[model samples]
Target: MNNAQEARRILRAHRYGALSTLSKKFDGYPFGSITPYLTDHDGSLLILISTLAEHTKNIQNDPRVSLITHDQRDPHIQTQGRVTVVGDAQPEPEREKAGQRYLRYFPEAQTYFAMHDFSFYRIRPVAIRYIGGFGRIHWVNMNNYAVADAEAFVQQEDALLAEVNARSSNALCRLLQQRHGISAMEAHAVGIDCDGLDVYHAEQTWRLDFPETAGIESITESLAQLLTATP
Candidate 1:
């Protein structure tokens, strides 16, 4: 695998992350929140926040933000590594598409969705601070990281997702409905990295990034075909 693939592997391993933003309520102090963010095809963050959410309000006041998601394991806790994303927050144009992608990974978000006060936010990463282990860390500049339009993920959502979600076919869909308690209406692709693909369903985002047998070119081609067929 390449550097991008390696970096993506570590990222897909963890989900929950702490997001820090400038506070709008308390004299602009630093405000931190435990948020669920989905990574898009090119590695940028996609989040859905309620308009009434403190972080959403804070972001409206100041778009700068950071998120830290780390590996959860024994010794790794001390320095297993956490990827920090520093970027700008802005409402995404593709709210419906993003919401579909996000809710799959976080099924519990159904409650949030029902409220109808939330809106989608997309992060455009300027730089990524990656820590491999204790004392082993480096900053990734834009050139080293992939920064594509937010639409890329949305545009490829349908077709590629079918392949990934269809792998286990009926069983996986049934499992999501029975065990996960998700209606599982449809599956959308929220993430695609050099390592694998992420297909969102309900509360559990299924990660398909098995580096040992991931085919980036084939997937890319499939997505390309789907887009052309979009009329």
Candidate 2:
């Protein structure tokens, strides 16, 4: 529907990616790791990694890297949609704040989250390569592909997360039940990276993926209304 919607779609289609880093042991060899990434609203990936991991070591040595995310299920892999983000990889300083959103997406990493060695890394894209499924392959011009820093919602993350989980979540649940005739014991927010928030309701066993970057505040309200209206 919009840039944020399109960005959210691109991210949902491909969750895992190949994170290529310069090998510390080998001078010419590039190291690759399959990583489950969470995309931020502006398209940067929020990766959960540990200082003990090899990729972490590589990233520390050099923050520069190229990360590729795509669907491997396609019969013709090349025909499937793929996005390659080339950027600098570095540890996120706001671990305690962003960790909530990151951990929500990946609950299994809770143990690692507690460990001092584990941390969140953000891939700040310098450029991106987007290949639309089937023959629509073209590199989006930087002007259109990258959202400006001012336009990105990078401040007050902790507050935003808290508000969403509290005010938004409850309202969303009530709306779903009232308008959609949906009933559930609980609603769990499964993921909240950057571009959108993915929530799960106990009754439907289905996911509600809502785009937040476009207008996170407004989108949250719209989703609640949509949920309530659905039958």
Candidate 3:
């Protein structure tokens, strides 16, 4: 895969990151906080935060922010792949839409979603730093990094997930075992994007990268090939 796609895959595999925002109370100093974020279909991040939160207050004072997430499963922190997104965070106007997608990944956040103080913020990336390994690194080109023709995929995501969960559970189970060596009695497709699919099994989520980029028209065939190719 290209550096950009690899960077996106890393971001999609993990959920939370260290968010750095300009502190409102501390005179524009950098303030860091751990926050859960969803990698949206277009590669932007969606985060739910309370208005009363320190990060939120900082964002209000200045929208400029950055978040870094790395592979948590890797034991060697220095060598593991990571992606840092330098971006601007703004309130997402489409609350219900964002909530639907965000809640699927973070069901426990339902209570927070219902609260009046909580709101969704979209972090649009200005630049991305991707470190593939100790020596593999690159400043991902924005044009190549961004997903093209993503609207169709986003609109069809729910239906696609429903079909996979309802009809392809066994295949998904085998896939988890084949790709991740984790045998699962049941597996559910919680999310799908251009890069790959996210499977929830055994109380944890596993990422399965597609052989190639998949669009709405090719996703079915892409999945079929992926499932059938594995054992």
Q: Which candidate leads in TM-score?
A: 3
The TM-scores of all predictions, comma-separated, are 0.73, 0.72, 0.97
Q: Compared with the true structure, what per-residue lDDT tens digits does model 1 show for residues 1-231?
A: 444445555666567789999998897788999988777766778887899889999999999999888854446586576788899999898767677767767777878876768888888887778777778777865565663433544565566666654553444454445444656666655555445555566445655444242344455654343333311
Candidates 2 and 3: which is better by lDDT? 3
* Model 1, runs deviating above 4 Å: 1-5, 73-75, 147-154, 167-193, 199-203, 212-216, 220-231
Question: For this target, which candidate reaches the highest lDDT against the unseen true structure?
Answer: 3
* Model 1: residue 195 alpha-carbon error in angstroms: 2.5
Tens-place lDDT per residue, model 3, 1-231, is 799989989999999999999999999999999999999999999999999999999999999999999977778999899999999999999999999989888888999999999999999999999999988989999998898857887889998899888888998889888988997888899998888899987667789889888877898998878777746
How far residue 153's Cα lies from its native spot in candidate 2, in Å, is 5.5
Ranking by lDDT: 3, 1, 2
149-229 in candidate 2: lDDT tens per residue?
423355544455555667566655765566446775566545443344455565232334543443544544644544445
Deviation (Å) of 204 in candidate 2: 14
lDDT of each: 0.67, 0.65, 0.91
Model 3 TM-score relative to the real fold: 0.97
